[model samples]
Target: MTMPGRTRTKVCGLTNADDVAAAVDAGADALGFIVDVPVDTPREISPERAATLVGAVPPFVSTVLVTMAPIESIPALHERVGTDAVQVHGDVDVGAIDRLAGDCDAALVKTVDAAKPESARAYADAADALLVDSTDESGAGGTGRTHDWTATHDLAASLDVPVILAGGLTPANVAEAVGAVDPYAVDVASGVESEGGVKDHDAVRAFVSNAAGASADGAEVSA
Candidate 1:
């Protein structure tokens, strides 16, 4: 299959409808909602709240339910939110992922820590896509820090599935990350937030713009 030529942007960890609107208005291709994650973060919201916000999203723009819930609980959480995709973090069950694949229609994205890119191999065949994230003491994601881009680059090149790069990405550095990894997509949460749950709209716009510029730069080089 041919991969998408452009580097897509996903603005995540939005807690309210207004923040959701801000991200969409900023031209984010996808918006993520953290729902009932085991880790404590201000971004985590009820499945019902995620559902309400997800439902409010306009068509053509994707909504993602980001969580670390048990594999068995995913179907219910996904059902409640009815998101277009699900980003699963932390320790995940491969067999359960396979089962969840059969149970739900949302595309499954398995997140792997950048420190352990090899761990991604197990899910490369299972998930529709893979997300490479920077993990910290807090949890799988929500780390306002960057990881080794060299590792992420190599992993993205080797993976058969589309790779989404995440962690410590801000408008200032996302272009550089995009240029380095050439990922299929880039995801950000804390990077674009004014506080924990509020979005910095200007930062959101710059992030998306820089990602696009990076894609254009790559295309120019390839040509």
Candidate 2:
């Protein structure tokens, strides 16, 4: 996939309509709602709530549901929430993802822990995009700690799908990240949050601004 000249921003873990609106107003290309049950994070929302939040978003703004469940759950979620995409964050098999792709009829974003590059590659083939994240054996993301960017960079370089850099990205270092790895997009949760799952609006704005600035510089260089 070609690298995007403007780094797309995905604001994850939104539970309410206000948060969803905030992310959209902050120039987010995509908004993620955590639907993982047995609730890993404080931002986890029910399918009904997710539907309400997704409804609040305007057209052209993508609504993505992040889940760790099997592909079987996607249909019901998609039917109710009307999501534009699904971000799978777990040990889901590629076949399952392919099944999800066919069933949900939405873009698939397969997330792999930064520690497991091999597994990332295996999933990348089946996904529309790959999200390189921090390791959390508990099945919860947004740890507020960065992983090895070099490893993610190498993985992105080798992959054919769009690589969305995640795992503790902040405004201060987002430009550096864009310069170093050149991901198709950037996903952030705790990095732009005042607390786990609660977004900091200014932080979100700053992060997007920095990424856009970097993209401008990158485009200029290419031109």
Candidate 3:
């Protein structure tokens, strides 16, 4: 968990070794690999590939498996990737999420659409952490659009699990978003990518540096 006033960062949609190294060098607390997503996305990679990248991650820098929300196959993917966490984005079933958490070694992070705020709390019972993201037309995340930070702030305050704010988060506005939401962490995919599935090294560094200093409580980011 993010201590006191510190806000962590997760850089998502990593598909290659360069991107993974870029995120790690940029000081990202967690790295997300999009594996077997139900919908079409340029960032998606095979579980075999995910394993290779995940295996190469240095200690303490978490590797997270990102995929659509369906509990049935998550355990298998989680096992194959050897990630530290599994972040699922979609209309999640609480019972299913609980089972996934119990079945897998990796932690579970569930994304809650800001449009449907009611579901966030229920996930707290099963999820290790909760993520707030702006959903796309298909009701899935990776919208590259910002949602109401005020609502997200309220949601975070009301939940027991750590809340990771994501969606359209860029270096230009991450400080403000951190100030507004005071989230436990911030996650970005497109905002740090030069193009889909490609990490913009400069952007990644700028984002990490910005988010690390943007704590609303006037404290340095936790180690």
Q: Any runs in candidate 1 off by more than 4 Å, and if so which? A: 137-139, 216-223
Return the TM-score for candidate 1, rounded to 2 decimals: 0.93
lDDT: which is higher, 1 or 2? 1
Better of 1 and 2 by TM-score: 1
User: Which residue pairs of candidate 3 clash?
Assistant: none
Using lDDT as the measure, name the better of candidate 2 and candidate 3.
3
Local distance difference test, each candidate: 0.85, 0.81, 0.87
Candidate 3 overall lDDT versus native: 0.87
lDDT of 3 by residue, 56-95 (tens): 9999999899988467988987888899999988776799
Q: State how far residue 206 of model 2 sits from its true place (Å).
A: 0.7
Stretches of candidate 2 off by over 4 Å are 216-223
Q: Which residue pairs clash in candidate 1?
A: none
**Residues 1-223, candidate 2, lDDT per residue (tens digit)?**
4485678889888876667778888899999988855545787888888898898899999989888765698778778878999888767778888887888878988888888889888987799998888858765567777888777878888889999888878998888887777889988887888876678889989987777677523432332
Candidate 1 local lDDT, 118-165, one digit each (tens): 778888889999988888754478788799887788888888899899
Q: Order the candidates by lDDT, highest first.
A: 3, 1, 2
